[model samples]
Target: MRVLAFLDGTLADPDAAHIRVDDLGLMRGDGVFETILVTDGRPRELGPHLDRLARSAKMLDLPEPDRAAWERAVRAVLDNWSGGAELALKLVLTRGIDGDPEQRPTGFALGMEIGAAVLRGRAEGVAAITLDRGIDPGLAERAPWLLLGAKSLSYGINMAAIREAVRRGADDVVFTASDGSVLEGPTSTVILLRGRTILTPPEHIGILPGTTQAGVFRGAEKAGFATKVEPLRVDDLLTGDGLFLASSVRKLTRVRSLDGTALPAATEAHAELSAAYEAEYA
Candidate 1:
């Protein structure tokens, strides 16, 4: 793994304790981030990831990210990476150290080979538990301060939820709104398949727009699968023809079970959709 920090347009070692203790992102979790997949030395869906990062920064009132600087840092780390496996490239932007007169933002890029656990989950499928997110689906529209759509650095709750799920003997979690509408996974997007139609929860429901899901839908359309956005419920997964959690690094992973109930097998669809997604980067 290698990390390169972009400080005022210059790149430096991330692990050398370069960030100040007063950095808002480190102190108050005031920041935004994106995780991109690098395959064969090329970042997949770089445009969408950067677009989302900009949107998140705007939502958080942080300075506009320097896309070119981030790109250079990504290239620097990837060029020096010697691993033959796929890599995960993370881009981070944080509000500058608190009380600083200049009020700048800290930005950096980190590159690491994809973990074996993530790869195994994608191959073996995953069992998930439904966790209540404790918010209504429409809350984001009414309360913008919640920052639901922004991929902010404040992920402590999300991480805790996943940890709790694992403690309960599940591999992951599918978060549902208070009204029982499926929102998304803690770190991935939820997608359902009924016949040849591919369905996902509407983005307006305070869920992060999934870059991998967008790519999957595009490829699905070409592969004769109708794509749709709809409100989904737990019953949808228990009875649907197939279910998956999609993301940039994890790619397309099937949901083998939900709440300990075995889901219908859709391995062929999963394989097709997974290949379709990979084709976008190819």
Candidate 2:
């Protein structure tokens, strides 16, 4: 697949040697990022993604991103894309080369095709395993430096947890707090449906406030479905009428099984929510 990259103020080949070796984003993962799905060359929920990126940058003490610059870069990459297929536009901002007294932040945008695995998970649903995140749900408010709500580049642990789940024969992971409250997926937001009510863990639980989930909730409300933010536990998942993962790229994906136990088939609810989510970006 052809991939494009925008570095600083210029668009370049993604494989080009542009990033410095001392970049803190690569060295220490000291950065923040946002990914937006582009369909038919139009970016989905661009404003909210940029808003979240700015918030994450502030939380990380990184330099503020130039939204106009990023927008120009996104347009350049999308216009240059050869395929008519959907693309994943990722914006990355790193605290520039380490030890640089200026501490300028490195910003870039990359465009690539959405992964087949992500598409498959959306279509076929996913089997998930619950993993302890090793922290209390209230930790973010007390420990801001932990960057719980910030979408940082430091995803080693999250990726490792997913790998561990794969090793255990699961497609993905739903991270829970030390208290066993369902938090979120490693790369997605967790949502549960009971009858016509749509529920997700409250943002106070230290999970990233999901842009897509917010859109889904808005759509759900307009569609006459009750939407709420509530604490969820393992038992809640087991007993819920339906479970799903929501994100910008993955959209709304059903959870077929959790920890090897089959979940209720909420196909009708899933279809309704999926349509509602699609309308938000359409």
Candidate 2 colliding pairs, count = 0
Predict model 1's lDDT versus the native.
0.89
TM-score of predicted structure 1 = 0.96
Candidate 1 lDDT for residue 92: 86
Candidate 2, residues 1-282, lDDT tens digits: the string is 555656434667777697899999999999999989888888988999999999999999887888888887777788788875688889889998999998988887888778889999989999999999999988989999999989999999899999999999998999999999989998999999999999999987799999989989988998889998999999999999999999988989999999999999798889988888778767
- lDDT tens readout by residue for model 1, 1-282: 665646334556656888889899999999999999988888888989999999999999888887787777777777776776688998989988899888888888878778887999988999999999999999999999999989999999899999999899999999999999999998999999999999999989999999999999999998889999999999998999999999998998999999999998798898888888777767
TM-score, cand. 2 vs. native? 0.97
Clashing pairs in 2: none
lDDT of 1 at 223: 85
